[model samples]
Target: MSGEDARALPVEDARSIAGVPDGFGRFWTPYRMAYIHGEGKPRDASDAQCPFCAAPGKGDEDGLIVHRGRTCFVLMNLFPYNSGHLLVCPYRHVSDYTELTCEERVELGELTATAMRVERETAHPDGFNLGMNQGAIAGAGIAAHLHQHVVPRWGGDANFLPIIAQTKAIPELLEDARARLAAAWPAEGMEK
Candidate 1:
């Protein structure tokens, strides 16, 4: 069928035909299926099964860690809303923000701020989205771990893709973003 002719057909008719152009974009991200299926999600709330508990054990590059602090660490979000998306997590295996010690709370805040600064220096986002999901009911993917999300934003970054297709298009590779942010991270006494 001609492209114009296909467009004129009822939407259901166009999508039903094999080898026919349906006028919808395809991202072909099979990798997202792992996330959809909960491949790496912790089986339980135990520290033994937690990714946040294990990340600090690996080298910085392998772990995609941006910086390590006394009480907390910064790392790139595996499933990012945008390039340079980061999470600030404490080494302790505690759930809920209320469980954080005074020192942990202070360092988590500091690390989250530093994550924003590094993202601005590296990707130059127009602004940021920063928060912590307290529980699974509150949208925390790993409800057993306490972490704060620091998501960088640019003007017009949102579109119909996520709402319509359940997909997000990230422009930069995770490794590349981790490297850039890690390099741009300010030293302990040098943070601005």
Candidate 2:
């Protein structure tokens, strides 16, 4: 969407443009998978049913499970950048990185490595942009739970949409990314 178009668009469009998770949208927080109820209490550091919580059930065919372990897992970005934008997150709900337990920290590190390796193998981008937007100030979409982002990047990935309009045009259907990654990646340590 163009900047002018973005400005003229609705708030829902803006959040969608920015990749914020709604009841039907995707967010990478290690907490609630997706909103269970739009009216239910917004979401807190304590909620665990977030999309990342359980083994994806019936309706989650498009929910890609890249790597799953007891404490951590890697998933394809339901919304993506290149081909293999992914998310690395602990299974538990954690708001602060400083509050992470030794176990969670270990899982976070290991899962991050696994996510990077798998994403690279799949996308083969020139570089990787790995980060965590801690809270609103840090541009966190899901502020309750902390998760690391693994975005694969090529030289020309940055487009004119944001340059001209301050809007991010992520043009691929999330289901497609999930299908491709889920087909290629075997979920590891998931049985536990």
Candidate 3:
């Protein structure tokens, strides 16, 4: 569909969108942010001016990066938990589900599984929290493109910092995580 057509479709009120109980009656959806509050003016990079999009194929040398593959790429979270935290974003910038094809969805799933397996090997977390924040109302910092976040977790991983002070304490930096994950990128059948 054309971007204008995508913009014209009706979006459910934030209060009605499932998965966020606190968001109900408490937040404005991206649709509301644009159409109602911002007077329909574009809020994103001019369809081609993304800070991340402008980034090089190898990603920043300071290292919030993983493999930049044919379709999608991964980046280490500047902030993280239990070592491995990454976001997988498509090379093409598309905001919502309607824009992704069946193959893109399948590839995203495989990439996520691979991320999980690599994280399990690299950090040995007990489990994980795979998430996607769809729009601003859903806490998407970069809401223009739908991406999957793979956050590795372990039992008792949370400490007094995250619980009492509303803060997370990640020991290593993004560069460290990038180097670590990059070292493991060539695992046998990793692309399977």
The 0-to-1 C-alpha lDDT of every candidate, in the order given, reads: 0.86, 0.64, 0.67
State the lDDT of candidate 2 residue by residue for 1-192, as single tens digits: 665676676656755785764634322222223332332322777676555555344244545666566676677655355567778777676777887889988888877776666556666778888898887588766677677888878888898755664435555555666666556664665422
Query: What's each prediction's clash count?
Result: 0, 7, 0
Ranking by TM-score: 1, 3, 2
What count of clashes does model 1 give? 0
Off by over 4 Å in 1: 1-20
1 or 2, greater by TM-score: 1
- Candidate 2: which stretches are off by over 4 Å? 1-43, 47-51, 54-62, 186-192
Q: Write the per-residue lDDT of candidate 1 for residues 1-192, one digit (tens) a residue.
A: 765666777876766555676677454466777778877777666848688888999999999899999999998889999888899999998888889999999999888888887888888999999989988889988888888999999998988888998888999999999988888888787875
Using lDDT, give the best candidate's number. Answer: 1
Q: TM-score for each prediction? A: 0.87, 0.65, 0.69
TM-score of 2: 0.65
Tell me, what's the RMSD of every candidate? 5.7, 9.6, 14.3
| Clashes by residue pair, model 2 | 3-165, 32-50, 32-51, 33-50, 33-51, 33-52, 34-51
On TM-score, who's better, 1 or 3? 1
User: What is the Å distance of residue 9 in model 3 from its true position?
Assistant: 58
Quote the lDDT for 101 in model 3. 79
Tens digit of per-residue lDDT, candidate 3, span 90-160 = 77778786688777787678788888877877878898999988887987666777778899888888877
